[model samples]
Target: MERYVDGFVLPVPTEKIDAYREMAAEAGKLWIEHGALEYFEGVGDDMESDMDGMPVRTFPEIAESSDDESAVFAFIVFESREHRDEVNAKVMDDPAMDPERPSEEMPFESGRMAYGGFRSLVSYEK
Candidate 1:
């Protein structure tokens, strides 16, 4: 089973898109170099509510009325949670993961950035 580091980022504002993209790109490379199998990112999209009042989507909806106009979703896959943690430790110590010296102008204030890790439970592939 594969493990993944999932990031749900709500940008501080639309102006931060460029900076956020740069940060993600740089982080992607570092993760890959540290043994991540894959790294990917995407912008959030609006979705319609389902009959049961649930949103029909794989990703979360971006909050309206937010100072930030967009959200960035990203993840890196690893063979297992153990491998994921190992690579994460390396990334943290790589001198490239400094939050203070971000590669680009961050969209949200650094203190607001949010993230978490997840393990594959059930997967359906074509």
Candidate 2:
């Protein structure tokens, strides 16, 4: 079956990686609880691509990260497009997921975050 994905890239301050990891773990739990098939968040460790004549920019370049910042790439998978919509609605309504709720300072700058919904064209699992 085809899948749907919501992807995000954030430029996070290097000093805040530990805080970011804690926040991501909590968010991942909420997403899974709300019916997301998978919730994955990764920090850039091998972002430096030295491939000669590469046609595209690397993750760090695309994220416009500075020396003090690291690229954070995250995605939540769903069974299908409709399922994604439903799950996201529920997740958004849950108060625990609200960013506005009184909490610790955000680990990353929200303005620089990039996000989009993608239709998975080719999915293979063995």
lDDT of 2 by residue, 25-125 (tens): 99999999999999999999998687887776878888899999999999999999999999999989998976675544888878889999999889998
Indicate which candidate wins on TM-score: 2
Write down the RMSD of candidate 1 (Cα, Å): 3.5
- Tens digits of per-residue lDDT, candidate 1, 1-126, equal 445555555444667677767877898899999898889987766434565876454333433325346656667888788898898889999987776865355555655456777878875545
Candidate 2 collision pairs: none
* lDDT for model 2: 0.91
Off by over 4 Å in 2: 102-104
Q: After superposition, how far is residue 72 of candidate 2 from its true place, in Å?
A: 0.7
Q: In terms of TM-score, how similar is model 2 to the real structure?
A: 0.92
